[model samples]
Target: MSSSSQEPQLPVIAVVGPTGSGKSDLGVNLALALNGEVINADALQFYRGMDIGTAKITVEERKGVPHHLLDTMDVTQEASVADFQKDCRAAILDIHSRGKRAILVGGSGLYVRAALDVLEFPGTDPKLRKQLEEECESKGLAPLRARLEELDPVSAARLGDARRVIRALEVHGLTGRPFSSFMPQREYFQPALQIGLEVDREQLRERLALRVHGMVDAGLREEVRGLDAIGLRRGKTASRALGYAQFLRVLDGGMSADAAVEETIVATRQFARRQLTWFRGDPRITWIDWQDPELVPKAVQAVNAASPASA
Candidate 1:
């Protein structure tokens, strides 16, 4: 018997891939086919009044498919993986109760990982995080990375960079334990199928370039101008978002509009590369080359083959 047979099963289809890889389209198609409701796993897509830049699916795009979590949070409020886990669990239960499947979709690797595993993390201390942020501002992230290298070599080695290293150090300083140790040691939740879209690097780059151009034409500059008026400066998570970040450079006289768009496309391509690297480490994810139209039917088969929930 399947190990999952003992638990109250909730049928979930998780569609994960790098940015601009058609993840949303696949999710929408799956939802339509499976009678499922889409629950967003993209962190950036949650903010209300921040639609076009995030490339959020419109009502027409959704084709009347119900989507949860998108447009659910304030731009200023930070949402964590724990909160995502909680929301996703509740959404899945609700979907099951309605006799429908839950389709979780996005390009955010952390969000996808949290949903796929029973993850636990030390409770955060706002003061400690603030202190760490202050330290980062004053001493620079390099010092924090160096400190983590001394204190938790394993984590430092795993992180291998300033941004992640600083975050791990902050968590360690706050929680009085290696930040890595707090992560769930075992798989608590496993999806029946974890589908990943694989696209050729050149193809992905082309898609990204086109998408960036489309965003510019779709008033992305105006959107960033509005965000600037609201004082959403660089370093704020919202401002650091891919499209907004590049546009900010344009508005600040740092780069020409054309240069900014090209830079954004380049950065987005790099980000997608990192996403592919992250998802590649997960053994459960089944990759379907993006050009393969056979992917959807195969995923559908996987879903249908999943064990039914025990009453």
Candidate 2:
């Protein structure tokens, strides 16, 4: 066991992995063991009334541990990692000030990095952004995408959709630098321990499919129906979330509930793969088997080993 020392450590613990990997449960267990509180980093879980689709942990599942940043935004508001970085750091500071360990938990890779890494978000120009948006609306994404490919091929390759492509163009236009140039380095702004859960790929595929089916059974359609009334479709980010986006097709009479469920499962699996690729690129995270029976104890050991005194 690592011993405490007079030299202070920031003492932030992160539980990260692919979707359906039980990160939330592990986070709660680690909190219970280490007397910590959780600060959520999952982007989808930020929306209010998005419980069923996001697979948010219920009150009973929280086991009395205080969770921060869950359901902090309405579905109609756009979720931004830059804004999340501020809120998450504040939550961590407040937790540490209260003499409690801050447990950062979620699968959103960028949000987790934004909280712990030394990342700088570039400033935006409203007028320039408006011009780009107008172009995207009138000429479509291909022209803007082609322009980005010319200016910043790396960013163009990385960004999948029009919103992100346009943002990359805006950033380059404003800063005279490629958006990918702002990629975070492998240094923490604070002392942090990242615990990643590993799973068998085939098993994860099956698990994710079943999980989507479970979400549908848990009234995901009704959940989307409720959010639609609150202008969910108009929300840039929330409207495009995994389960919610697919179910919107059902509401549009474009597909059946079964088709929506299947599409969600497939999309979720692809997303999980992307998440794994992103996390695997970072060498700092300590990976553990998801099925380990002594998971909590192992996580506690990792935390202790990463402490400043242990170092």
Candidate 3:
């Protein structure tokens, strides 16, 4: 065999889309059809006992296909995309070495990109970060967000919270460049295929509402109650997760259970819109209708077409 033929064709597939878009089930189907194992890129799914809120696939749901990187962190631990990039890359490599396809699955846009793109994260300075945090505390996020908008309108427009706004400011303070400038370009670090799932906006809104109601019925409040015992509120990242955050308000008597569920549904719909915007900006993705019955087959075909041998 020629040297090119002798080299292994490692499969790196990423299934990405909005919440309630059937990404997890599609990923599992792809894995089963393509001899692949899953590496989670969902930031929320990394926390242990965060099952109900994050919609993490249960053991029975995974259907014997091995999954990596799920439930690996405590609720009190901060989840870092940089750290996830390292861990996910290692997991992908290990899966390839074992002669299996590697499936990267999640709705976390940056996390998925960090796994497959030639992206570099700037180093953090503790003192600077602390100063920025203090500033946010003493003054307000308004000043920081305004500054970010002036410096990097793109990032400012996308980031909605104070913590992330502060981090962007910290990046600018440290690097002397707009945080938007550090955004990943359209370059892949590995040979990979990205599949995106999309749904009609009205249908998606309805689906999200139903899903949130289902989660509440499935004991999401109880899940949060359990995590509260483990100091979930102390975790910078985990505490801010969509469903968890809303339910925490309910648990604190700041909101009613019914109100919490409604709020989570709205927040999730907005989040899904953001996710769709992020993924749609990337032209490399092969988008499929989420409700298509032939979704798995179409995804499999896309994967095969992406393989070098098929080229």
Candidate 4:
């Protein structure tokens, strides 16, 4: 460690919060204050032409802070946690090399952990995945889920749905280890401080509803229509984006536009609740109230205290 008198090494500062809690604004301000660049961890924001639904920040909103990892993937591509880990770490290193801090911002808990924590992503084999997929299709998900319960009860209980069940089995088959064994620890990959935004439940619900309405006004319906033209439904991840999924129902005649809009608001609220649960479970995060008048200054204080001269 260097002497206490020298400037300390820059940490990868992370600004985390639920959707519509102003994470983007806080991230941009933090970057400006800390001489940092923002690295997006939101999975949905990774896709091109996914701006409106994901509530991605515009170039003007970025306020001249260089943002990385946005719009790097096409809607047709799957967003992999493994791939994101590799890319996000590279961006952090590049920023640090250039003597700038890296501010990772997003509400995707798993993706955030992948970027900052000591997380291991199990490798995949195509043949193994295909064989397992076939087994799932032929014998049904019951047997595979039962087998997973026998081997890795943790993952079996946690992972719901056929796809995740098959994935767990694949990990066990290839690595001879339980899929749950790869869960991330709280340990940071490098020096880092996570500043989470805490918002009032009732107020956030109101805010999210208004935000979804604003998206509709901002041509979200048209954006979804255009993406569907290019096969949005075929893109597993993109197709299920919060507003995009409901809007697709509008396109398919299963639901009216107004109904889709209501469902999107509800879905966004539920998602925000889940995000809060995930972040609240982590004890290491230093949280600031989203409505705090001096949010930036408080965040900066947390950052400085996190990595002191002795630290």
Candidate with top TM-score is 4
- Residues 40-79 of candidate 4: C-alpha lDDT, one tens digit per residue: 9999999999999999999999999999999998888899
User: TM per model?
Assistant: 0.86, 0.91, 0.88, 0.95
- TM-score preference between candidates 1 and 3, better one: 3
Q: Model 4: clashing residue pairs?
A: none
Supply candidate 1's per-residue lDDT for 240. Answer: 84
lDDT of 3 by residue, 210-266 (tens): 989999899999999999999999999999998899989999999999888888888
Cα deviation of 26, candidate 2, in Å: 0.6
Which wins on TM-score, candidate 1 or candidate 4?
4
Q: Candidate 1's residue-wise lDDT over 149-223, tens digit each? A: 788888887886566776787788777789778665436485557788988988888888999999899999998
- After the best TM-score superposition of candidate 1, give how far the Cα of residue 172 lies from its true spot, in angstroms: 3.7
* Candidate 2: worst-modelled 10 consecutive residues by lDDT: 1-10
Ranking by lDDT: 4, 2, 3, 1
Count clashes in each candidate, considering only residues at least 3 apart in sequence or on different chains: 0, 0, 0, 0
Error of 2 at 239 (Å): 1.2
* Model 2 segments more than 4 A misplaced: 1-6, 135-162
Q: Rate the local accuracy (lDDT) of all candidates.
A: 0.81, 0.92, 0.91, 0.93
Off by over 4 Å in 3: 1-11, 132-169, 172-180
TM-score order of candidates, top first? 4, 2, 3, 1
